[model samples]
Target: MKIVQISDTHLTAHGGRTQENFERVVDHVNNHLRPDLVVHSGDIVIIHPDDAADRAHARTLMAEFTAPVLVVPGNHDIGEPGAAPWAGIGVTDERVAAFESVWGTGHWRHDAGGWTVLGLNSELFGSGLGREAEQWAWIENTVADLPATARVIVFLHKPIWQVADEPTDHNLDIGESRARLLDLLGTVSLAAVGSGHLHCYRQTRRGETLEVWAPATAFVAGDGDTFAGPLHQLGIVEYDCADGTVRAGYRSVPGLDDVSATGVPEVIAAITALTDSPVG
Candidate 1:
């Protein structure tokens, strides 16, 4: 199957430069790429996880795509997860429920073409909530029982690692659950893992798995990078999976302006108003 992976659209009904760029992404996917499926690696809305209008606008914008879309929840969609989540916007059950009410299940599995594709809710990784435990249990049981010959691919909002010792909260490594999740995945016939949160694009090879970071369809983090890392321009990732192998590539579409979160004044103002933290 041909799949296009888009991430971090950061939609907001209020003042949405992100949504304007995202509509270009939608147009590109519809008229040019024309993939069989489009998987969004999350951050579907900008800050303010409680904003229903943002989520509704996101849903409406995504409807422009020609193919079916699947999504995983990013920190912006369901709040951050650690004990010291950014600006104290930690993930909660109510926030998760609200995310699901619009985006459907943030965790899901689809089987096709000899491959098992899994979408995980990254906001639940270390949230210490009942739903987090439930997701872990499901992952354990499901991952353990995967067909020995089936090629597996996992998609989530947060990555498992980063470049060398450069640490960033943009990944699951910030949580204590990384080792366990990796160990479980290590046992499977993993083919590739895809993620997006850093608002950047990168790739790494771990044993037999290809880890790809799909860049944001929204703005690059730039000066607003609460969690710092490489800042790449906006784009998407494409994957071709067939038989038991997958090929991945980064595609930078046309007409996407390169700017930081400052490009959207409303997003910056929301962060300051809600979290009492200025754009760092």
Candidate 2:
């Protein structure tokens, strides 16, 4: 199956150049790449997590695509688990409901192209919410019932690992749920884990699974200390899976300014500070 992955569009209700950039991306996907499926890793909207207008606008934009699109929730769309609120915004039942009311569900499972593709809400990883347990149970049951030969691929907003083996307290990683999730995956024929939260594009292989980090179509993170991979670029990741092999590639959006050159040091600083803050 041909799949195109785009993340962190960060669209706002008022609309701006970023929205235009997203339009260009949809056009490119429809006209040039023409993938079989489009998956958005997360962060479909910007700033507030419960803005109905922003959510509506984002939904409208996503509808422009010709291919089927599946999405998981990012911290921007639904607040991070155990983290302090950003400007009084945090994940709540209402926020979760609002997200689901528009985007269907935060988790999904599909059997296609000789693979079982699963998407989960990373915000619930360590949230301590009732839904978290429910999601975990669902994942366990879903994976447990799959055949031993089934090829599996998982998608989420935050990654399970950032550096090699060291674990950080950052909310962007899966935190306390990492061990359990990894153990669960150990039982399956895992193919790839695709995610987007770092606002950069990176591909790493951990044993047989491909770890893909799709770049944000909106803007790349500017902080150098926290983000070690390529930054300040806007793009998408394309993956082709057939039989049992997966091939992936990155395509940068043309005519877009990198975050560093956009002269938004204060915006970048705010994001970096918010993400770096300790979980409350």
Candidate 3:
């Protein structure tokens, strides 16, 4: 089975280069590399979590893909939640509800080709919100209910790795959440844990589980990021799941630009936009 993973679209309502880029991705996935499934890891919107127009736009754009698409809420789609939430906006039940109103659910599970593919809301961890525990329980139950010998694949938005010794807002994993999640998945036939938010493509192995960071479909950073991959390339990840294992290959669209995130005006505006986002 082949799966295409796209992430960090950061699209606006009216339309911008980001939307154009995502559309290119959709066309590429449909025309060139037809995959069994498409998973948009997160960051479907520009910034505001409660931006109904952006959410609606994302839904419409995502529906263009021929294969079934499963989405996990990104910090941009729903507000961020951690020691240092982005723009002081944190994930809340209402923000989560807003995301679900368009995307149906913040998480989902699909049993496909001997693999149990699962999506989770990463922002919910350490959120201290009402739905945090609920998502945790759902995750535990979902994994527990899977077949004893079933291989599992997990996807979420923010990465759960401790990449730096000085964990800032960029590298924050919210304390023991990573260990807690890994421990729960330790019970399953874990194959790969896919994520985005880093805006670059990278794959690494932890013990036996593969960690894939899908490249941002939108743009790279011109001014550099506090904790970002050195490669400023933009693309997607194609995962080939067979032989009881998975191999990930980075794929870029034919004409997709390796533009900078700061060069995009829409993205900068989004970073400074205010909202009644039902978050901190």
TM-score of candidate 3 to 2 decimals: 0.93
Q: Per-residue lDDT of 30-72 in model 2, one digit per residue for the tens?
A: 9999988899999888765766888999999999999999999
Better of 2 and 3 by TM-score: 3
lDDT of 1 by residue, 179-262 (tens): 888898888898999999878887778889999988898888676453444447899999999877889998888989888888
Worst 10 residues of 1 by lDDT: 166-175
For every model shown, what is its TM-score relative to the native structure? 0.91, 0.89, 0.93
In TM-score terms, which candidate is top? Answer: 3
Q: Output the worst ten-in-a-row residue range by lDDT, candidate 3.
A: 167-176
Model 1 regions more than 4 Å off: 162-174, 223-231, 275-280
Runs with alpha carbons beyond 4 Å of true place in candidate 3: 171-175, 226-230, 275-280
State the lDDT of candidate 3 residue by residue for 33-144, as single tens digits.
9999999988999878878988898889889999999999898888887666777767888889989888878888999889889998888888888788888899889878
Q: Sorted by lDDT, highest first, which candidate order results?
A: 3, 1, 2
RMSD (Å) per prediction: 2.9, 3.7, 2.2
As a whole number from 0 to 100, the lDDT of residue 165 in candidate 3 is 79
lDDT of each: 0.83, 0.81, 0.84
